[model samples]
Target: MLGRRAFLKLFGGSLFGLMALGGYAFGYEPVIRLDVTRYALTPPGWTPGLKLRIVALADFHACEPWMSAERIGSICAHANGLGGDIIVLLGDYTSGTDLITGKVGHRAWAEQLATLRAPLGVHAIVGNHDWWHDAAAQRSGRGPTFSHRALSGVGIEVYSNRSVRLEKDGHGFWLAGIEDQLALRRSIRWKRPFTQGLEDIGGTLAQITDDAPVILLAHEPDVFPAVPSRVSLTLSGHTHGGQVRIFGWSPYSPSRYGDRYVYGHIVEEDRHIIVSGGLGCSIMPVRFGVPPEIVVIDVG
Candidate 1:
């Protein structure tokens, strides 16, 4: 029932409103997500008397020009301060393949990560990236500047996927580290294969009384398939929980073995599997649905 002039005025106002809203709708927006999950589980062999808390960090592609030394040091300090009795660093230390050739990028990368620390000891296992880099370290002449010694210098204990016993608070638990599923390459030159020298899940755990708890630290969650049922809990940080899961699903994870292993926690066949969305960036310097995380897990 409005007159022509009034109709035009109303149309102009409505059009202006739509235009303003549409501008924001098409704005450039980078997607970002942060998820924090607190998991509490009763492992098959957890003892009633002792409590063990471990902070896990992984997939820190600490290559130069990305993760600076100061930044790496800060993250390490933060992980150690989580008040957990133990801290673990899963590998993917650098991205360059020049370690064997002794290059600047490799050296700088290792030196930075050596800064990370923990109280119960910062234990670690190599990822495929670690294995790939080792090939570089094995190079001759102007070999790359990085070395496994870099981690040792900073007091980080790199564990070959094998089990070791720990006595804490008068009670003892076994901390088992496994060579990555990609251990095939690491075994070619090393004295013994990862699956060898290390206790098979059954044998490695045979000596530990049923009452003692076990914490398995591996670089990738794929190890879960081969891990024995005895390990109370397994901590891993590859796949970054899919790094970019949408609606609770990750689009892709570079788990050499399979993309089925994204990131986050999984319980299969009585094993508590926790995969962390590591602290640093990788090939595609971006994380959408999955933000990097430092988990403080408490077990009693």
Candidate 2:
């Protein structure tokens, strides 16, 4: 049997530990930690002798005191130093949670992102929050959402069910980006039954005119299983590695498939997907176990 003094000490210690963990999650991980995660792979049908380095940033829920324009600029500068052949922005540029002290303007972040430098240029795709938070687009069930317009206004091409071809050292491949899979809410009043998606996977793939290998940029990893083998690789964010993970398991994942598509490299049926643990928080401003990351992929 435990003594009264021992029980009291144990309870106090546990409370202190919990408070300390909460402080780290709220103050340190999301605000100050930035990790550079790297992966290298040669997809099943990639062109021979062709090497591509891709630097990707995702889910910048831009807000004051969290993801400010100056912070974004610093991140962009770091990415530029990486010497990527191409850079991809993986969406959710707007504030994802209402816990922000102040919202970041679209143009402010866009202007900072414009500083990003890559030989093949910068490309972008929209995320669910980009559509859900846009009042005009949500009301109308369509977009040129603010995120899309802001990115395009800054000279970065934002793809919506679009494909473009790029070459490196004479080897050509198609880069495709589809619209967000959860672009709109079925009911703003109830916010349930989110059945609508702006994505057109088949339509996007159809635009690829050649047999050259393809890289697909999707905002959510849920689309990976449905991705055809024709696409050599699919890159995604939006899960943020469940925002709080423990021992490679996330207790609360926003993904319908849960931890299966939550983070890192996933392979199925000769197809590959890399899901980034994105920068910034959503639903709440807290992070633990999974730190903010800039993903770098070397593909052949």
Candidate 3:
């Protein structure tokens, strides 16, 4: 088996060099975003006068052959194609272990993928990669990926354990983004006071009106099982439907969480979870049983 880096060099060269001849000639790269616009939710005692559509893309890893600027643009175009009102991105911007090499690829690709345009607005939280040097090391020798500034430029809100309110038609909802518990490695040093649980973020959620429906976005599904039952819905990505599935099942997913939340919609009573296949690839560039996905959720 070839090393991941070596494979990327070969794959990226093929992808970029083939550009002059027109689009790459390997396969039918698509601009497909799963249309879940019909996904409906009715909070108790809530009148249905409003509709909300969100585009959720996650685990970018931003690798060479899998996550090219061209491909991401395809996904973005697909998202815009949705007549939906709002768009949200989960996380994981790039995939690399070496900071220097990773950042170079991230900067180059990030510059290109920044063209996403959405109507209600785009929001995101960092994935393990975006934090685990899941990004560029130092273009000029800088830092890791979590950025309110850089992502904001692309119209994606980068949130870490934060919340915001959206209201219309005399009804309202609260959206909260919590820090990734799975992404605990990078945050160890700075966490002086030492907090053990995600409850630290409950204060942010408190800002919302108590009766309003609330939605949460956390990158890793590992975070979902722990979310308080109070949260109405949670959105996530990072598994990539095991990135490579055998036959049709994700042979690679090892968590006890099961395939219940693998890819697509999972509804349990009032608790709903959406795990997107995302627009990029990681760990390995090739995909089987899973095409990269952009998930749209219509919550009213």
Q: What are the TM-scores, per candidate, against the unseen true structure?
A: 0.72, 0.96, 0.72
Query: Could you give candidate 2's per-residue lDDT for residues 175-219 as a string of tens digits?
Result: 999999999888856564665898999999999988999999999
lDDT of 1 by residue, 91-193 (tens): 7776522222222354565666566555567676666565556554333312222434566666667766366788788888888776555533424455333
> Compared with the true structure, what per-residue lDDT tens digits does model 3 show for residues 1-300?
989999999999888876632331113221232333335565443436766677676766655454556666666777777765667778777663231222335555555557666655677776666655533431222233444345766555767677888765566777788765554343434542332323235665766666666778877776666566577778888777776666768877624577766766676665677777765556545455566676767666
lDDT of 1: 0.63
Which candidate wins on TM-score? 2
Worst 10 residues of 2 by lDDT: 186-195
Worst window of 10 by summed lDDT in candidate 1? 25-34
Which portions of model 2 miss their true places by more than 4 Å? 188-194
Which lDDT value does model 1 have at 291?
A: 63
**Candidate 3 Cα deviation (angstroms), residue 155:** 4.5
Clashing pairs in 3: 61-94, 61-95, 103-136, 123-157, 129-134, 138-141, 138-142
Model with the higher lDDT, candidate 1 or 2: 2
Ranking by lDDT: 2, 1, 3
